[model samples]
Target: MTPQEALFKYTLRLGDNALIQGHRLSEWCSKGPILEEDLALTNIALDNIGLAQAFLKYAADIEGKGKTEDDLAYKRPERQFYNHQITELPIGDFAVTIAKQLLISAFEVPLFSALSHSTDETIAGIAAKGVKESRYHFVHSRDWCYRLGEGTELSHSKLQQAIHDLWAYTGELFEMAEEDTILLVAGIAVDLEELRPLWKETVATVLTEATIQIPEDGTMHTGSRNGVHTEHLGHILAEMQYLQRAYPDATW
Candidate 1:
């Protein structure tokens, strides 16, 4: 891919991750375990959605197609999306949701921190905001992990089960795509491989303090960087793209 194409894809991937993750978190809107926690998740969802908009808008600009961020977000097909597969998985239960947040936010903290210094000005600006938000997200998820992991027999079991179920997907978060290699050379993309060590340390620290056992790494799930994903992504796209697909050109 040309540098321009690589850059566009890179930006789109960032937007995809945020958009799908924001959608998943938004599902917790009224379903949170408590009212305060419910509002907190909703606010985080909004933060991610806003981040999505920023990234997607930048992606569209890079593409130079005159397509708006909404079009890119609401019009893309499933196979064209590049979100990490973990973001598309079902939010199982409170423990599972918290576990997912803990793992993803742990990765994001280091990922965004490094990206905040990207050579690409727009991406650096976006990542700067992402660093602050991701840090908060990490703290929130880390606290929940402790509460759930040490709270009760059932809670601990559920959290552990969640971790085991999701661990394989985490490997994909650090996988490098072709665009990543190109951007890595240009200093426009954060080195995902470099972020893995810190991510593992963050996750291990939290899980250990919560008395949760980290699962052994097995055959790792992969492919989102190539637009391949679990069946879950199609379902998410079906709901998310419904309005735009069904009512083309219609506006409020």
Candidate 2:
């Protein structure tokens, strides 16, 4: 693929991850454990959505297809989406949500930090802005991991199980594709393989502090990069695209 094509696909991958994960977190809008926590999750959701808009707008511009960010987000079929499978999974319980957030945020923190220096100006700018937000996301999720993991017997057990269930999906976060390799050689994308060791260190430190054992690595679930996803993504698209699909061009 051409560098432009690689960059466009890379941008879409970044935006889709934020868009889908934001929607999942928005599911907790009024369902957080407490009012403050509820607002926190909602605010984080907004952050992700805002990030999505930035990346997708740039992607649309790169594609020269005249598609707006909304079109790319709400009009795409499920197979066209490129978000990580972990991002689209059902939120499950509170512990599960935190587990997902912890895993994703940890990756983004370092990923964006490196991307801030990307040879592509737009990507660098977006990463610079995103680094701060992702850091907060990492901290928030990490704190909660500790809170639940060390709190009570039930809380500890649930958090541990959440970690166990989510571990299989973490490997995909570091899985590189040809598009990624292209950008990597051009200095326009992160080397996810490099980020993996740092991500593991950050997560392992937190898990140790929480007195939680890291699950043994098993077969890693993947395919999101190639547009294959868990069954959950279809449901996400059905709901997220409903308004646009049902009433094209209708506006407030």
lDDT of each: 0.92, 0.94
> Per-residue lDDT tens digits of candidate 2, residues 1-252?
898888888999999999999999999998999999999999999999999999999999999988999889989899889999999999999999999999999999999999999999999999999999999999999999989989999999999999999999999999899899999999999999999999999999999999889998899999988899999999999999999999997678
Backbone clashes counted, model 2: 0
RMSD of each: 0.7, 0.7
Task: Count backbone overlaps in model 1.
Answer: 0
Candidate closest to the true structure, highest lDDT: 2
TM-score of each: 0.99, 0.99
